[model samples]
Target: MRSSLRPLLVSIVILAAASVGASSARAAASGRPLGNATRATYPSVVSIELLGRSMLYSVNFDQALNENMSAGFGLGSSSMNIHNTDLDANKSATFLPAYFDYYFLNAAGSPYVTAGVTLILNHSSVKGTDTSTGNLEIPSSPVMPTVGGGYEYRSDTGFLFRVAGYLVAGRSLTPWLGFSFGYAF
Candidate 1:
């Protein structure tokens, strides 16, 4: 009975979120065409995010395939420090991320789920103070898989705002929370 209820609860939650995007009520009150509130008009979105799927920050571009689906890619960079017992170092890395987003509606505001992978290219600009412990192990490249969900607000005039939480999947799961500001032109 408990297991059976899980799916039912999830369905209810999804339906509730989708219902928030319904514009018929707003249309009736404001006297505008409901057709205007859709992804059909604006199919492309460009955004800049902090601590997003890139695991740091990114400038992203996405094209909507339909009302519910989108695909995109991003470029980002990070300056990190590794301070520990064995090694102390600071490095700059570049990240390339690719992802897809599934929106619950085509309205001005909607809920969305996203999945992506990021390729990290580690640059050889390591700065450290403790070299007596023989600091040597360095990773050339690494790829991480990520998934998350969030809400997006897009206006008819092309303004957009988004917030999301992401999980990096691997031997250890790392969680990241991010937000973005962009346009949907």
Candidate 2:
């Protein structure tokens, strides 16, 4: 019984090797390379951004899934003073943005459109000369939906630049413009 099993095993192995060789030969004849073909891997980029209104600042990290799609997250803050009063206000927001880019024109520089949602946390305080109210502090938290588009330029040497505009929905729709510069690794 052991001798018979050995012959059967050798026959199975020989058949398997012949099949693999035949597949390789077929692929070669068809002009198609087989096994471990080269593929493009997109790099991740990190950046810091400054918003034009309300003095907002943010840090963002994005990664390319393919040539035309990327996704990222951002954290930002802003502060301002109210006119005709001694009141001050401050706000901070976090965003999850998804981008769809058109890379048809140029690979180094591409224009993209983005849509995102943000979780916004706002705090306000009033100070000075208010005997009746003294010092007052207010805190509010809300979720804001947003949409925007931008143009970005990235070089092979790691230099990066971007500009974008966003409309955030709240009690009213607020527009935000941002500029960013960073290095890509």
Candidate 3:
């Protein structure tokens, strides 16, 4: 049983790494069809939230490789200066999220739905009590996966306006409610 399990574990790790490598390559190759393609769509989005003492803002951009696929990256950060009991104890955090999207319908200037997974890395700092009545800072790091869906409005010139909401599951550091605005190019 041990021998069989060893090979299976190795195979699983190799497959996972290969899958990530393949998607990275695809995102790079997606730009290849630019000149001959009918139009390349791109979207840029900005979002803001108000939840008690905590506030957050995020921005992301998407480039449409073809009619059915897209990839995007976003940066976000939040701060809690009020320090309420209900608020998460972390003073601040920053996250970088990347995702690849597949559009169900094929067409320009039409509404389409997308499905994708997001890889997020988070860095946080928490305040703690110090002996001298001063505050001490504790740092934390974590990574998580988020899945979501949204709608896109394509255009003839390859620029688009999109609105999407996704629930991020895993650590509750970031709120489950999130939105994206991007374009397909």
Candidate 4:
């Protein structure tokens, strides 16, 4: 009876080991850990960006159409300071940019492309030292079309980092670059 029980226990242990090896092999072939794919999906992110000439704070909502593609929209605004010491003048610009983004996902990080428009409202003033008049104020509003692209990295723990650049077409071609950090939920 003892000999028979020993053989049965050894058979059970061998079967368990084989099942574990097979499952691990399947996971290895897929190139993803057993439970990681499901944890990687986040539908929305909110971020604050420090741009080349401004500061933008925005919220974005994204939907993953597949494993490699995502579509999203973002809205943000910035109040930028434009200063020229030679002219003794200071200017401020307020911009509202609304855009759509497309993301390409990979094993390393995700890269994205964007297209958008910005409503720019600007105001400027000359200092009294530069002119006889105490102060002179000028204001203007322009609608500009823009396109941009960027890369984003999101860690498994929900921390995110992004770097992006934008080209705005107005009276002159203006380039804006930004870096942002945020959380994904």
Prediction 4 global C-alpha lDDT: 0.49
Residues 1-185, model 4: lDDT tens digits: 44523653564455445544554455556553332422145445555554522333444445555555555545544322323223423433455555666677553367888776665544232111111111111123355666889987754434456788877554445666766655545
**lDDT at 146 for candidate 3?**
51
Q: What TM-scores do the predictions have?
A: 0.68, 0.57, 0.49, 0.54
What is the clash count of model 1?
0
Model 2 Cα RMSD, 1 decimal: 22.1
Tens digits of per-residue lDDT for model 3, 7-100? 5356445544554455455556565453332223343322221110112345565555666766666665554332323334434545456667
Residue 66, model 1, lDDT: 89
Question: Ten consecutive residues with minimal summed lDDT in candidate 4?
Answer: 129-138
| Residue pairs with clashing backbones, model 4 | none
lDDT at residue 169 of model 2 (Cα atoms):
55
The per-residue C-alpha lDDT of model 3 at residue 98 equals 66
- Estimate candidate 1's RMSD in Å: 11.4
Best model number under lDDT: 1
Instruction: Candidate 4: list runs displaced more than 4 Å.
Output: 1-40, 52-91, 106-108, 121-141
**Candidate with the greatest TM-score versus the true structure:** 1
Q: Using lDDT as the measure, name the better of candidate 1 and candidate 2.
A: 1
Question: Cα deviation of 86 in candidate 3 (Å)?
Answer: 3.3
lDDT of 1 by residue, 80-133 (tens): 446334322445556678999999987878899999887665534532321111
In model 3, residue pairs whose N, Cα or C atoms come closer than 3 Å (at least 3 residues apart or on different chains), thus clashing, are 40-185, 41-158, 41-184, 41-185, 42-183, 42-184, 43-182, 43-183, 64-184, 64-185
